[model samples]
Target chain A: METILAQLLNGLDKGGAYALIALGLTLVFGTLGVVNFAHGALFMLGAFCAVAFRQFITYETVTLDPTKLSPWGAPLEIKTPMAQIWFGDFGAVLINWSVPISILLAIPVMLVIGIAMERGLIKHFYKRAHMDQILVTFGLAIVLQEVVKAIFGANPISQPMPVELRGSADIGAMLGLTPGMVTYPIWRLIYFLFSASIIGAVFAFLRLTTFGMVVRAGMADRETVGILGINIDRRFTIMFGLAAVVAGLAGVMYTPLVPPNYHLGMDFLVLSFVVVVVGGMGSLPGAVAAGFLLGILQSFASMTEIKAIIPGIDQIIIYLVAVVILLVRPRGLLGRRGVMET
Target chain B: MNIFYLPRRDAITLAVFALVVLTMPIWLVPFGAAYPGLMQKFAIFAIFAVGYNVLFGLTGYLSFGHAAFLGVGSYTAVWTFKLMTMNVIPAMIFAVIVSGLFALAIGFVSLRRSGIYFSILTLAFAQMCYNLAYSVLTPITNGETALQLTINDPRVLDLMFSERGAGLPSPSLLGQGMSGIEAFYVVAVVLLIAFYIAQKIFVSPFGMMLRAIKSNQTRMHYTGFNTRPYALTAFVISGMYAGLAGSLLAATDPLAGAERMQWTASGEVVLMTILGGVGTLIGPVIGAWLIKYFENIFSGFNDAMLHHTFSWLPQGAQDVVVAITSKFVGEGWQLSLGLIFVLVVVFLPGGVMEGIRRFSSIFRNRREPGPTGALKTSPAE
Candidate 1:
């Protein structure tokens, strides 16, 4: 029973990340009616942003000692700003902060990238067929992934957790059980909490705010929104940006869970796309619910007992769920009627 | 006079195409020096693209998961080798039939939705198949992490299998060992025939209905024509073509992997169709050939090739040229593909074939100036 509980907790952590990313994806896909294939790339960029900032912050310079200096060692070198802040007191004390700070930086950067992508590439696709939009966005994704690879190389870049939170917390000990059992990483717990918070905030903003209300109205009927003089295009573009930032922020927080890589975006893109579909194209809450449900289901499928019975069950779980759901409920669990329907 | 001029241009074009296909080995001999393996790859992909074009170009439904059918065909062919004999033709036929059935199932379900929903449904199914192939279906897929031939595989249909590993007598010509390149040429010829048949179908009455449905399905349905059958026919035909291409790929390499059905692979076919000029009969083949050429040949040009080529130039100039060209080659090859796709979509939406037609018109018109321009102007004029 405890083991099951443990697995469930772990599943929730993973589900949280999946839900966050899917929520963002569904927002753009649902509202703007543009399948932004670059959403994953934006997420990757966000994670990479964390890595980049950390790399910058941890950039260090070594001063050569006359007695034991290497043949090629410089006498003295000035470090960058990040190094100065993170590596103070002549390397005696090192402060390699957690990924959260970099994630904070990613929001604005992602928003900017989202807006730029919307204005530059995706805007032209609105009038085109979904096929064209998919093609162009796919091309854009390739460009984005390639650009990252060219700049950062294909190697997976690690984003280390803070020294203080390096190891897992003993939940077992806390619960009057044996020590060192039921261990969960602090960073992962924080990620889950953070994702839930973001998801809540997005939902709150949409449910409560006038901008979101107008966007929802726009989603139902673009012409109606336009007739009301809401500047639907600009709003849609901003929504694209918001979606990008959401995906990016998810990526940033997720760096501690899964190291940021160029192809990470591609990996997440398909599953998130499935989530978007299963959640119903334009339903925000639906996306969140489906993402978590699928994530947990997938996690359960990876159990040893389940694997013993069914080979590759873990890999195909989400897809099987998707197929069944699609056949049963073509519009998804909460999809808005007539949105991208035949 | 009408008899003498009865679409002489179409006949001439057909003859020229046939002639080029017949003499490919001779014309492409020089290219073998630079790219030994590419021409064959070009032909194989051309078959796949042509098959994709049948559904996408004529029917106007853009399938994002066409590669799933192709992969299905390839896997079926490879399994036929393992279960039955090494005779490629039987395997190819089985592949087409199996993939056709698979397509029928998927299309029946997915075609219920139109536009983006349909595309997404197909995509989801393809992804599902890919995931299953990669993990659970590994036993049937040879259990090899990467698709490859193995010696220990059971040949249930091998009548001559011996515990002593005895040599059997030589088989007939059809079952005899043929080199990979010879096999490729055979497939290429078959593809050319398929392309020609597709051209005929495009101009046929059935083809007209498909196009009509694409323009407006509601109107066609209201007019009392069953649009479902036409669309389903297009889907099945395209699926079979993809399957045939897949079987050829397996026959050529004798292995199949799930990667063939990746969304990216599906996207590649779509890009090929769009880049070559959607709705144009020969455009897909041209597009596929171009992409395969770049993917296989251009990417293989390395820094060493660059350094050798620019050896005569001054140091700085040579470095600059090498740097610029390096982007088109090496790990950055996908950049070129992406750039081409974006450029073609944004600037020349009609695609490469359209670009070629326009360019040809310029030269053809320059030869005979105003009177012919007026005389040859299409109906839109």
Candidate 2:
């Protein structure tokens, strides 16, 4: 029972990431009628934003100390961080919270990237074949990945989680079941809740706002919405920006869980696409449901007993489910009847 | 006989293509790429791209997991080497069968969806194969160290024929060594044959059907035709071609690694096909050769080479020039490829073939100007 609960937590955490990425992908598809292959690049750019931010904040200035000499007979070098030197304790605190605070930095950067990508490149391919969009975006993705590799090198850079959230929590004891029965990482739980809130915010924004209403209407019937004399095109561009922000935030939050590598986006991009397809193309709720569903199933498949029964099931369960769902339920779990069906 | 029938111009084009491929070692010397190893790879990858062109260039189905077929082919060829004989003919045949079956299964399900959905499905399936090959199928694939030939109890055909040798046996044809220049000839011959088949398919009725599907699948379906079978056949045939290429890789060097099956390798073939010119006979071959050249020769340039090349400039200017030029060469060749691919997709969708056609047509038009000749690149002579 305890094992199942722990695995459920793992599932929820993984599902959170999948849902977040798929949400943005589906949003772009639904709103702009585009299949953004470079969505993964946006996720990668967001993580790099945090990496760059941390590097910027804690950049060190070295000085040779005349009073202290090193073991090698050279003068001892005193290194002080630029941020902490300028801002004192406040700067130190800022560096400590840089991972989470980088969200602020990631948002604006992702917005400009999203808008520029749409206006400059994606805008022209709107009427081209789907293959062309895929090709161009794939080329863009390779460029982004290689550029990041050139700057950051090929190795994964591990981001430090805040000291306060470093340990595990016994949720079993907190829930009054058994002490130390189920211990899960605090950041993982936080990640789950963060994703839940983001998903809620996106849904609420679409449900409540007039702009979102127009956007949703446009998704339903683009021509009719355009014929109504509204500047739906500009709104869709913003929607693309919104999707980019969501993907960026997901990448920012995910850094502590998995080290940010140049290959991270391509790795996640494939899984996220499978999730979107299984959830039924252009179905937001379906994407989320499929995300969590696939995630939990993956967690369970990795169990010892499951591995003994069907070896390597954990590695391939998500893809297997995608294939099955595509074959059996072509519209996906919560997909509409006609979206991308043709 | 009907399949062999080609128009006079296309027949001449085929003969010229064959001549050029067969003599690559001689012509490539000027570019310093005349070595047998690089020449062998040129022919092998050219075969891969030509086969790939049937499905992608003609049909427009952008499969993203094609490396899985190639990987399977390599694995099968290696296994054949272990279980049967070191001869490459049987290895190639078995590799084709296994990869063809693999493609059949993948295409049956993936072809159900078109556009990005199909691409994703293929990608997912290939990733699954890669993962399994890395883990559970380690016995077959040998995991990270790679599947290789070992001196063991197997090789049933060789055992029946002669006494066992003390050392590892290399790939050969009927006990004749098939390494170095021989391997290049074998690959070149395979490419010429594959090119001929591709040409036949390009002019066949089925090829026209594939083009129709590329232009408008919905209209084709609405016209009471089942296009899935045709697409699946193309997919399987191309998969076999990839297998042949993979087996050739193993035949040259008897080792198969899981990394060869990665999506990145599959993407490379797509880059080759698109860069050369989709749906053009000689385009994919040119694309493959160009990319292979770029990957091998362009990336070989180092800081010292760059510095030496720019020595005519002043010391400070030479360093600056080397720094800038180094990015487009060496490790950043992929960036150059990406930039070129993006430009092609945006401005020149027809790729290098289109560029050549445009260049030649301009010369042709200056001599004989007419409205009817705009679309055709007739011989200047």
Candidate 3:
């Protein structure tokens, strides 16, 4: 029972990430009608935003300490982070909480990037073949990743979580299991909650707001919406920005879990794409459902008992699921009829 | 002539192409790219790209898993070398057959969907193959270290010929060692044959059917013609082409790595096809050569080489030039490649062929008297 619960928790944690990334992907696909291969780069860029923010806050101020003298130097130098020097305790708190603080920084940054990407490159590819869109966006992805690699070098940079959130939580005792049986990381749980809240917020915004209704209507039929004298293009562009923000925020929050790296975007991109396909193209709820389903399936596959039966099945379960889904149900789980069919 | 036959001009063009390929070693020397190994790779990858074009360029199905076939070919060739003989012929044949089978299986499943879904399915299958090769199939693939010839392998043909000696024997044809410049010729010949087959298919009814499928599959379906077989055949043919290329890669270098089957490798061929001009006979070959040249030659350019190349400049100017150019070479080759991909896709959708045509037309217009009149009158005429 404890193992099942542990696996469920693990699965949900991973599913949160998948859902976040796929949600963004489906949003862009639904709104723009162009498959953005560079969406992963946006996620990577978001993680870097957090990294940059952390670096900015930790910039040091060097000063000479006359009272202390070095053995071979005139005087000892004291180095303090500019944040601490400028704001004292609050600055220390800020530095410790850079991950959450990065959410603020990533929103505006990712929005601009998303809008600029749409306006500059993807705009022209809207009318082109799917192959052209894929090629161009893939090219853009390579450029973004290479530029990131150039700046950060080709190494994973670990981001420190806050001191309060560093340890694992004992859920076993609370759940009436053995005391030490179900300890899960506190941050992962927090990430799950954060992602759920974000997903909920997005859904609520879409459900309750007039702007979202218009956007939803536009997604269903752009021509009809446009014929009704609505500037759906601008809303769609904003929708693109919102998707970027979601992906960016996901990336920002994810840094503490998996160290940020130049290739993180690409790694996540493929999996998220799989998720989107399995969920059914252009179906937002489908993306979320498939994300969780695949995530749980993956977690279950990783169990030792499962591995013993089908060796290396864990590594390929998602792809196998994708193939099976594609074969059995061509339109995907929640896909509309004839979405990409000829 | 029949509608499916090559035009007279196309026949001459093929001959010229054959001549250029045959004499590549001699002509490439002036450009410092005459090394036999690189030249061999040029031919092998050109075959791969041309085969890839048969599906992607002729038909608009953008397969993202062709590298899986290539990997299959390499593995088969290496195994043939290990178990049977160091003969290139058997290895090539085995590789092609094995890859063709694998392609048939993968294509049968993936061809069920069209467009992005098809791409995803292919990618899924390739990634599955790659993942399996990396983990469970490691015993067959030799895991991450790459599969290479070992001393204890049973070489039936080698033992029959009494050719056992110190170190591993090189793959040979008719008792002649197929390495160095000899291997280049072998690859070049095979490339010509591959190109010939591709040309024949391009001008054949099957090729027209593929083009028709690319333009509108629904119409083809409604016309009472089953489109699945045509697509499946193209997929298998292209897969065999990739397999042949992979076999040649092993036949030349004699090692096979799982990385060869990676999606990035698949993406490289796609880039080559598009960059050179998709659907054109010579475009993919040019794209392959251009990419291979950049990968091998441009990446070899270092700070020292840059400094030496710009030695005629003043000291400060030389440093500045080297600093700027160094980033786009060596470790930065991928960046430049990305930029080129973007620029090409954006401006020259027809790729290098389109650029060449536009350039030639500009020169033709300039050379003729009354250029505007000539341009207007020529189209009407």
Task: Please tell me which predicted candidate would have the highest lDDT against the true structure.
Answer: 3
State the TM-score of candidate 1 restricted to chain B: 0.87
TM-score for predicted model 3 compared with the true structure: 0.93
Worst 10 residues of 3 chain B by lDDT: B372-381
The TM-score between candidate 1 and the true structure equals 0.88
lDDT of each: 0.77, 0.88, 0.89
Q: After superposition, how far is residue B317 of candidate 1 from its true place, in Å?
A: 5.2
- Scored against the true structure, residue A185 in model 1 reaches a CA lDDT of 85
How well is each residue in A149-223 modelled by candidate 2, as lDDT tens digits? Answer: 878878999889889999999998887878898999999999999999999999999989999899999999999
Give the runs in model 3 whose Cα sits over 4 Å from its true position. A60-79, B1-7, B304-325, B366-381
Ranking by lDDT: 3, 2, 1
Q: In model 1 chain B, where is the ten-residue run with the lowest total lDDT?
A: B372-381
**TM of each candidate vs. truth:** 0.88, 0.95, 0.93
Q: Kindly indicate the candidate among 2 and 3 with the higher DockQ.
A: 2
Worst 10 residues of 2 chain A by lDDT: A125-134
Calculate DockQ per candidate and list them: 0.39, 0.49, 0.46
